[model samples]
Target: MPKSAVVLLNRPSLEAPPHVEGAAEFELLDVDAPHVRVLDLGVTRGDGVFETISFGAGHPQALAAHLARLAKSARALDLPEPDADAWERAVLAAASAIDPAPEAYVKTVMTRGLEGDGRPTGWAYASAAPDHSRARSEGIRVVLLDRGYRHDVAKTSPWLLAGSKTLSYAVNRAVLREAARRDADDVVFVSSDGYLLEGSTSNLLLRFGDTLVTPGLDQGILAGTTQGDLFAFARSQGLETEYARLETRKLAEADAAWLVSSVRHAAPIRRVDGVDRAVDTDFTAAVNSHLIGRTS
Candidate 1:
């Protein structure tokens, strides 16, 4: 089975099939078939947390960072803490099952389990990543959509799970769909107060003159692993970096901006709100090299 296939894993019977005993073609399952009860909050109420780690060179890049975020997300949901050792084993097994040639998206999802049982339903697996070569090379068109929340919402509403990367992604997907209706490839979400937040699935980054700026974490944005890594790399390269609140109008004055994430990496935003922005391929190349390092 290809890694991309959804293999059911039953937590009760944690047994690997014979074909999965050794190296298999894209291992998608490590245990028996799994079936979630219809009443499970994870599905019915979208009560869960997840992390997507970039799998390459036989292991996940930024494994520690991803796991840390997963733990934080789980805590935010009041779900059971993640078993790092077990997750480590599952992730390694899944990554090893993939064909060695292709880069993969390895995800770990933990839900609040059944409505009453209280046991968390967690699994880690690898899958083929959707190709973003065109967007990476040619750049992407984006539109700004109001996130419909104030920047201070996180501080005032704990139940909202503001900074948590929860599984409740319906709104995010809907926003992206709306962006598509506007003939845009992606979306940059801004707060109701006109402060830049983040993308539907990525962290927003801007290059303002010689300085790099990203929205401050206090604004209720999911902490982006990719953005954190890139910022460290940028500083090492002697670029000035700042984490401050930004207005959507900053997009117009930016030398360049991108929606950076673990899977898509760094993709330039050529057009914002149907208006063309700057594109610096050389800068993108340099940053990508720093982001992924020279893998030989």
Candidate 2:
């Protein structure tokens, strides 16, 4: 992944990775009046749709699998999916921009669009943003916070609950930004009910000696793909995987902790507010091994 250089905000141009470059061409969808366009509202508003996929070297999974998942995610939100041709085109665009030898992150967004007044018209468009991959290999620190939308379950779309990756994300983004502001690498969000939900942009997990514990989707987690992979990986390693309600305190008490996602892959928690973060030695390898996936 290319490290994003701090060019002036007003710079004439900027070089971005495949996902980001693919997203820059969001005009293919018409945002004109009454068309009910789907914008990548997740980039700003909390209301939109998005997906993250892993891309390394020149290889990404074949289109069928990736598209099926994308389509499911879209149908879950009842959002319009790109036509097969459009989806393929976007994939190719994103793929073409990928550095064949590089490991990177790809995020795609589709949101409702704007109105004739030029303001957000309640339509949607999609975009992609890819990034440098090495940091996931290093590790990042995250601080936990007690914040999230209560309607995260009931009022939101049924198929979308913590699963659809919608964009109406002001709270999540603000929390993550605050974490960065605190000089922490990322954020972990706890619910008012005292259950550990997820990191700002990742899924939360911990190892309680022999069991791998992650909050259940009933606890309002985002149903992470990486978390699912980790579960399978844990089971294969003879580790027990459990999805139960997790107390935030359990994170600090666990033998090890990780915030999993496509961008971070698997971020090791190095710090926690008012708690010690040094993980138990026995759990380190189990924590790191889950992110080493090579295929679908």
Candidate 3:
């Protein structure tokens, strides 16, 4: 199996091996070093916060936004406040070490350290991004899956970590697996009452003529960095945007839809639940050009 090239942070003594073949370009740095202990809560109970960022030509685009989101996630978990300065330095170091590839992903993770320890274990690394050409250009088939929660669960059930992007993704992964079993490429998670929520790993966006629609942050969806950024970009281009309670049936009524993320950027959805829709090439290109191309 091919492995992604990685660059370790805060561990100077470790040595990274050479890169292995993979879907996208990457460079390795310090692959053999172990950075965490078995007793850490992050590993033991999936108690941690994370952010995935996209870097191109050695520069991290939207890095500040990602770090801000990471801090919010940490706060939601009541973990120790992250040292943003330190994380920024580490991310830059990793990015500097990576040989320039078309693009790569840098994921920063901060776990509540050992169960009894107040210190948090935080580190970051740079790796190759997964190839999303097919999904981006050819489009993807998605299935709607029930998230088994009410849209307002985030407000009523804070313990659910509703809007936080934590390391606990067992349920999210399971939903994607189910989507695969249904012969779909991705998922759009809907709430129990039939409101569209988000994707297992990405945020959902729908196009209705000149408008871009997404489930509101109040609906318990992880406040998506890419989605928010794209909305801003779209509005700058004179496109109207909205945040509303989307029904499952709304998928078939849209001009187009997409699953957006940091690493993958914006992937157009060609079909939803086996129903085909016309791919809006102009809309996709405009949105992606801003979302993926704007690296500064």
Candidate 4:
């Protein structure tokens, strides 16, 4: 089997017409081949939605939640609703085609196809995940940057697509570069109005005594699938969970913190703007163990 695999969906959305009149639901393709068109809106305008699902021992973690989020992102972009069953099958197929590993990820993307084509392009690409042991164990240094939006941006200006996980992530990538310039590893975006938002590509999680708090969804942050699972796990372990509007100062005051996401799982925040912070080593280990052992 190849180290990586790709499955191109013929009909990403049942609401829209198929790519071909009569073709298979999807096709396994060469990972190195060019599949997208130059004029595709997803290529030219970054008009699309995506979800990256991590697989543990070949079982895709939080598969249902990821698909639901993908559909939600599609709705936010006014794109056709993704066919969950089809996407699930495609993801599984791609996952199976790749070499078995302790950790792997399958990324599903649905794009607004060529202008006026009225058809969308969708595919799932699977590959073994990168080694995140160093960051997960030693933790990461984070810097707070201004996201240039208000906490109420999602409600006030939904057109900005604040909470949607779209293909346009230039700003997200730029934040990491800025963090690098500041001698940090990652970023936590603060709203222009002085509210803590989220990480560049993950959700902000903080520990306050025995409670785990994260910025509320209303703050224009993506509803993190990994964070959701972590919340459930925390509850099972007798930790209280909350979603609230957090101020920038809250990050510094927290007992321990992390930036949680799918591929990276939970990376504890050990430093902020060069200042050291405490890390809950025991809890972090337990969190990662549960994440890596998930079968559903």
Report the C-alpha lDDT of model 1 over 1-296, residue by residue, as the tens digit.
45553332233112212223344322355444665567778889999998988865555778888888998988887776776665766676666666663467777887776776745676676777787778877899999888889998888887899989999999989988899999999999989999999998999999987788999999899999989888888888789989999987888888999899988888999998988878978878777666655231
Regarding TM-score, does 1 or 4 come out ahead?
A: 4
Candidate with maximal TM-score: 4
Cα TM-score per model: 0.89, 0.68, 0.90, 0.99
Q: Give the TM-score of candidate 4.
A: 0.99
Poorest 10 consecutive residues of model 2 by lDDT? Answer: 4-13
Local error of candidate 1 at 149, Å? 0.6
Q: Residue 180 in model 2: shift from native, Å?
A: 3.0
For residues 128-240, could you state the per-residue lDDT of candidate 2 as single tens digits? 33442433444566777876544246345464355556666666778878888877777777777677887777888888878988888865566677777778778888999
Give me the runs in candidate 4 sitting further than 4 Å from their true place: none
Q: Is candidate 2 or candidate 4 better by TM-score?
A: 4
In the order shown, the candidates' Cα RMSDs to the true structure are 4.8, 8.7, 6.6, 0.6
Task: Compose the digit string of candidate 4's lDDT tens values, residues 1-296.
Answer: 99999999999999999998899999999999999999999999999999999999989999999999999999998899999999999999999998999999999999999988888999999999999988899999999999999999999999999999999999999999999999999999999999999999999999999999999999899999999999999999999999999999999999999999999999999999999999999999999999989999
- Sequence-dependent TM-score of model 2: 0.68
TM-score for candidate 1, residues paired by index: 0.89
**Between candidates 3 and 4, which one is better according to lDDT?**
4
- Please name the candidate that would achieve the greatest lDDT relative to the true structure: 4
C-alpha root-mean-square deviation, candidate 2:
8.7
* True-vs-predicted CA distance for residue 126, candidate 1, Å: 0.7
Error of 3 at 132 (Å): 0.9
The worst-scoring run of ten residues by lDDT in candidate 3 lies at 12-21
Whole-model lDDT per candidate? 0.77, 0.55, 0.79, 0.96
